[model samples]
Target: MKRIALGVQYDGAPWNGYQKQLDRHTVQDQLEIALARFARVDVATTCAGRTDTGVHALEQVVHFDTELTRDTQSWVRGVNTFLPDSIAVRWASEVAQAPAHDPHLEFHARFSARARTYHYVLYNHPVRSPLLAGKAGWTFRPLDVERMRAGAAHLIGQHDFTAFRSSQCQAKSPVKDMQSIRIERSGDAIVFTLRANAFLHHMVRNLVGSLIYVGNGRQRPEWIGELLRARDRHEAAPTFMPDGLYLAKIDYDPKWGLPQEAGSLLPWFSL
Candidate 1:
């Protein structure tokens, strides 16, 4: 059997999440069902990240070992036959497994990943746009981007992000290396792009919620650093909605040869 890696993109609005559940509409369930139908065998897939319900992904890397052999292009088009309009297999490549005795092979859809990127989109308007209701989060109060930037600056680099982590998070460590965070405006939409070694559950949304507080002058920018030092979840803002969150991209080593660009896979994002 050969291990096959797949690049997946999906709209999370229609499904519960990436993980499969009994009697639930989920991305993994749909994808596996389609793969089983096409390959005529069971297909258990492992992903780089598990997004929350209503949280979309631009380039989610997943892997599954199968005895069936098919070319890259065929894998993309064939499995899509059983998938819904919300999900599609973008690209496929065969991952080379390490020799049993070599003990150096470290490639995995989740473990092998070096970093993950997320984008949170917010529409700063008094009246919410019906067109972007489920596509983006809406904020009625005017947001000061500079204030948000100041708050975000304190979050960069290595730190214990316990204040921003979700109560349901199961990550072993609260310490994470936040590589970069850039908040910019595209038209009326305020976009936040963050890259981290790994994120705790609801980390991005929680951080965004607190930043929104700073942006609207409800909280001072210094409150971010204070919260970080506190390492208490209660000190941070409430977790924002998942509607605006997107798993924009994932970073893997060159040996894996994964796709680099996020492209226009999702409806709202251009990154």
Candidate 2:
């Protein structure tokens, strides 16, 4: 068997998310179907994380085991040929050994990644943007970027992120290490950048929603710190729309023994 890694990018608006569903189109379903067509066998994939519906990805990672003896270049072309226009396999390579026990076996990847980065787009303008409606979260209220940045600072560390996670989250624990969270405004758009070891469901969206409240003066900047201490979901803001979010990147340590350029072929956020 040959174990191969794939770097993918997709417009999430057309599908149900990364995981396959019985009757819905999905990133994973498309990839697996394409792989089965190319290799002529049913194949399963393991992804770095599961994105919600309408949430895009610039660099999503996955691995699969196949019996095919094709070159890396063929894997990329062949997969793309079978996939819809919304999905693309940016790169592929054979791995010496598969990352360890599959997540499906026990809900954990074999290796630990260094970090994952997510970006959220908020359109702050009086008029709605027809071109960006499904790609960004739109709000007409003016936001105080300085206040949002101040509120974001309180989220930079390991803590119980229960307040920022959705009740539907299936993680074993609410504790997560948030390396950094920053809020920046460019013109009429607001961007939320977050880097973490891992995330629970709707964590970034909920965090952004809470910060938006601070930016609008609806809540104090220090309230984020208090919410963290409280560790209760009701103390946080509502979950923002998934359309504004994107999985920007995933990082793995060099000691993992993968190629140095393993991540280079993946796409990045354009804005």
Candidate 3:
């Protein structure tokens, strides 16, 4: 059996999340159903990341083993035929696999990932836009981008992110390498881009909410550093809505040759 990697994009509004559930009302359930229909066999898939409900993904890498021999494009177009309008397989490629006796070296969709990138788009206008209701998060208060930047700066580098982690997070550890955090505002829309080696549950949302507090002058920028040092979840801001969060990209080594699209927040908060 050969391992095939697929690049998938989906709007998470219609599904519970990326992982499959017994209720069969998730992105993974839908994708697996489509895959079985296309390949005429049950196909199990593993994803690079598991996004929360209502969190979109620009590119989610998945790998599955199959004995069927088909070209990459066929997998994309064929599986898409059975998928809903919210999800589509953008690209597919055959990847190397290690022997079954030593599977640790295989090109795993989740294990082989080097980094993850997430974007949060927020509308800072008094009145909410119906056009972007579920597409973005809305806040009535005016946000200071510079203040938010200063607050975000404190989160850079490897640190124990317990203050930002969710109680339900299943991650083995709270220590993570926060590579970068970029905050930009285009008109009334503010975009926050964050990259890390990995993230705990609700980590991005929690961080964004705290930064919003700093932006609105509710909390001082220095408060973020205190929160980090304290490592107390209760001292941090409440978790922000998942509507604005997007799994923008998953970084992997070049050997996999997966066709990944560039990350962007266009037509809304382009910067």
Best lDDT goes to which candidate? 3
The lDDT of each candidate is 0.89, 0.82, 0.93
**Any runs in candidate 1 off by more than 4 Å, and if so which?**
263-271
Prediction-by-prediction clash tally: 0, 0, 0
Better of 1 and 2 by lDDT: 1
Sort by TM-score, top down from the best: 3, 1, 2
lDDT of 3 at 126: 94
Model 2: per-residue lDDT, tens digit, 197-229?
999999999998999899999999999999999
Instruction: Work out the TM-score per prediction.
Output: 0.96, 0.90, 0.97
lDDT of 1 at 129: 92
The residue-by-residue lDDT of candidate 3 on 1-271, one tens digit each, is 8999999999999999999989999999999999999999999999999998999998899999999999998999999999999999999999988977987768999999999999999999999999987789999999999999999999999999999999999999999999999998889989999999999999999999999999999999999999999999999999999888999899999987878888665555688
lDDT: worst 10-residue window of model 2: 260-269
- In TM-score terms, which candidate is top? 3
Per-residue lDDT over 180-206 for candidate 1, one digit per residue giving the tens place of the 0 to 100 score: 998987667898999999999999999
* Structure candidate 1, residue pairs in collision: none
Q: Roughly what TM-score does model 2 have, to 2 decimal places? A: 0.90
Alpha carbon deviation, residue 221, candidate 3 (Å): 0.5
